[model samples]
Target: MKYLYYSLALFILSSFITPNDDADYEKEIKEWHKNRIESLKKENGWLNLAGLFWLEEGRNSFGADIENKIIFPTGKSGNFLGEFILSNGEVFIEAKKGAEIYHENEKVEKLKIFPSEKPILLKHHTLRWFVIKRGNKYAIRLRDLDSPFLKEFHGIETFQIDKKWKLKAKFEPTVGKKIAILDVTGQTSQQDSPGKLIFTVAGKEYALDALAEGDELFIIFGDITNKKETYGAGRFVYAAKPDADGFTSLDFNKAYNPPCAFTPYATCPLPPKQNLLPIAISAGEKNYGNH
Candidate 1:
């Protein structure tokens, strides 16, 4: 009789105890979203992008003047700030006499812009520019540190944090597969694919092709939410590489808009046809602004 009483007492005590696991999970998601916002507000983020001008094979004049081959925002620079010379596939930038162009905080009258491990950044006042090569094309990507987009950015909208969107996935390896990825610029490139991530939602199973990105798997996906609440092109998410057992997790709560959703100047990759799901995935970030 004493043993029976002790068991009853323990059961009552256990019923009063509440697990904080859900609360802790919600906090973690909020912290991750905060870091995402911080990254987008940084100098190298997509918010500052102002222009993307394709460079011609010869001299391309750049300034505030309408007649210049590459026109900058009026009143931001002199009427004739500089010229970009493209010769035999090499690019060089020469600053106009009164234009004070600085690279790494050092004044530069002329400098080579291409043939380097990283894009060379040149700054003038609040404007920053660098050369970007995409496929066989080269272009000048310009950024304004004081861009209205950056200043007006509030925060991204996200779905209610729910643990149901966190799912267990199986990684099925297809090691030598290459997927065709189409960019916003109408260029299609082949990217290396490591495998497919198969997961189930609402008792239905779906698979997404996984792209190899360093130690993580990069996923560009679209769903029924795209037509309404999310970016039309798709959302991007990163999943941890599968372990020896070929298992991983797909946390849709971490999905986010591509750079193209934030800026027109960005050439973001679209989701492959096979990755588009017919089901509603009401998680992650929603579309920002009218874009």
Candidate 2:
């Protein structure tokens, strides 16, 4: 929602693609935190995630009972809710007899979810589900409107909002550099590395490897606080891409926890080895509940 224009000319994009000047740290951080909380309360946020059942290659039965192949929380749906047929990387859902289910606001006896021709939103009462693809495997991510976490939700704990933590950094592109990243699920993946960010903190030189994420540069880094004060897995930060002169601002105040910090169901990438900094970054969101 802000932009820091460099001497080089390039159209400033949205906050998802841009950074801003340091003159308005209080206002920007306030807006950022408010939006973060709103996003978490949205229908698709991690707070509502109740179940993540991996589908085996075959007919996977689902219901509120534990005996089903995909067991949802009890009382959330009928005992024999439905069946998901996973075959050849495709999944088709067959509702149980007399089941009251709706897809895109229409009654359905069956529906092909994976390779979905259209956006498939399956809902039964307050339960919502969709297919999630991780690597070559498929899993059903279930959201419950009545999740206890969402009900008990307050707000995230954060380090003090300080303007000093926000600093400008030099973005130097490494061209074809990339790094291996591992998620909380132990699945390894790789992302494009546009460059390294060079910045100074407390008179010491520091650098971070950055991943190109759409229009913004994504940073997953760890600090000394990670061992005690911060999330053990690390934290995530985003910055606008470098302009022609190769410069962008790194606002540590905006650094936040990964999805895995909130839920075990999430697959959040761990910070690469090179991004780990020796000094402590005492800004941004702190540890939440025990995940």
| The candidate that achieves the highest TM-score relative to the unseen native structure | 1
Stretches of candidate 1 exceeding 4 Å from the true structure: 1-18
Cα TM-score per model: 0.93, 0.89
**Candidate 1 local lDDT, 1-291, one digit each (tens):** 999999999887766543366777889999999999999999999899989999999999998899999999886777888899988778999998979889998887899989677879999888899998788888999999999889999999999998899999999999799999999999999999999999999999999999999899999999998958999999999999999999999999999999998888998999999999999889999999886
Error of 1 at 207 (Å): 0.6
**lDDT computed for candidate 1:** 0.92
- lDDT, candidates in the order shown: 0.92, 0.86
Question: What TM-score does candidate 1 get on C-alpha atoms?
Answer: 0.93
